[model samples]
Target: METLYDSIRDKTRVFERTGVASFSETENGVQVLTDNGKRVEGSILVGADGISSTIRLPAKYRALVGTSRNQFVENPKLPFLARGHMHNVYYEGISGFCVQGVQGLVFWCLFFKEEAWPDPRPASKFTDADCESVITKYGHLRLGTHYTFSDLWQSRVNASMTVMEEGMIEAPWNRGRVVLLGDSVHKLLPLLRRSVSQLPSREELAEAFARYEAKQRPRANICISMSNLAMRFETQDSWWLRLARRLVPSIPEGAWMPFFVEYITSAPRLDFLARESPVGRAHDLKSR
Candidate 1:
């Protein structure tokens, strides 16, 4: 992230420890107000903020929300969980593990169904005993060969419980000069790590946003549907789905190669870029 920040430092002006209070469109440009009473103006405003985006509220009146609340299952932590690599492990809906700042210190999270918990309380509302009760209930499950849910829970430097909300705002990704990007426009299940690709370049800001939505909406819908399906298959105790899950692991790896290859090859691509041959020349050999 530092490397990325450094690379863009020349072209980017970053405002740290700042909160956006409001935004408006003016004849000159888009204007943003910070909580500190400072105002900034630019030709266009892009909201790259995450799921709880303030910019998204104006785009859609409502969003389609989904959630996965299930019993525990374990997998190896993300490879980047080790020192010098920054990332986290999210195993389906049951738990997410991360190592931050301090080396070898891992954090785990568990989310409960709204019906089961009933109270819409913040993480601070839960006590250590409350967290322990949850761990005792599901900690017997395996996370990896080396660690059970309990093993990680017991070794945790810290722990928290929270709710996960997933959804996509309805169309109209932009309202006048304020456009949306990243989780602000589309929020998918955690199963898929990648976000929508970079917005294609266009001379007009509205045209750029239009092309971005056109390119991303279809792929986002596909991912959302698949992620929902996966959650249901993994979390629901339905007989057929459970049976299929049991059999899936035992199947040989190469059996799904054709389907995997097709899915990858058919993935959406930005249409504006010229196709390139293996040698790096434009395949059509046409000048832009």
Candidate 2:
């Protein structure tokens, strides 16, 4: 942003916009909402104000979304937990992890303990002090198994993990003049870990998005549910916890490449779609 702003700062054509005031449709086009009732008429409106947008939408819709409510706190007892390594602790059917990021920074998850936050915020709001308290309270704090707060890059924080599904706002992603994009269409759970950008052309993006939602919705939901279940099983803090951790390799990936390829494409080579499969006619294609 800084780089782009600097490069375009001198250009009169490049200007910043603020305060959406109002808009109306006309025979020619539509007018944009602006401060002091200013107008910048255009042919279209793109609602990109996030999942729970503040703007009044005509074709309003919703997608099932899951959120993780996190908070940060200081952990003076064990400072090293702020380093970049994973510390997964389990108790009963609940599971969670204390992982570190940059210097003095830790990211955490508690899939078991439930809290309510229908309106989610960016995860960065959580602090280091908040993280330590949560870990010390819920986690079966192993005194010396891994790095603790004392080894913190800066200080310790206790972060909360409150996961919830948005059940009320669920609907098909489109209506009429208003269509949804991003979270408004299909709200992904944390760690699906990818973003879909606006396609180059408007028509191109709309068509592509329609296809994407149809194919990807079921699979994405399954991944999120399975992840939660897996976390629960892994974090059992009973005498069984130790045994489970030992038997499982560190960081087992629950992914199948061949299965995914087959699901999305007709065949590995897509040759059948091309009139002939290379598997049966490799030599014929090579000779040609």
lDDT of each: 0.52, 0.43
Candidate 2 lDDT by residue in tens digits, 1-288: 355367775565343555557766555445676785656665444443443343212221111111111222253444435345567655454554555565555654454433433333433333444454455554453313654322332232432332233221246443322344444433442111123543234454446555645555665555546544444455452466556666666544555444444444431233333554334543344333
- lDDT assessment of candidate 1: 0.52
The regions of model 1 sitting more than 4 angstroms off are 1-4, 7-13, 51-133, 140-148, 155-165, 187-203, 237-257, 268-288
Candidate 2 TM-score over all chains jointly: 0.42
* Best of the candidates, lDDT: 1
Query: Clash pairs of candidate 1?
Result: 74-143
Model 1 lDDT tens row, 1-288: 365468774554777768889998777577899999999887677766743334333321111111111212343343224454333223333433333344545444443332354233443355566567666876666544445557656555455553333467786877666777667655632121223434322235566566667777787877667655555453432467656766877989899866655545556444555656453443233322
Count clashing residue pairs in model 1: 1
Cα RMSD of predicted structure 2: 11.5
Minimum summed lDDT over a 10-residue window in model 2 is located at: 60-69
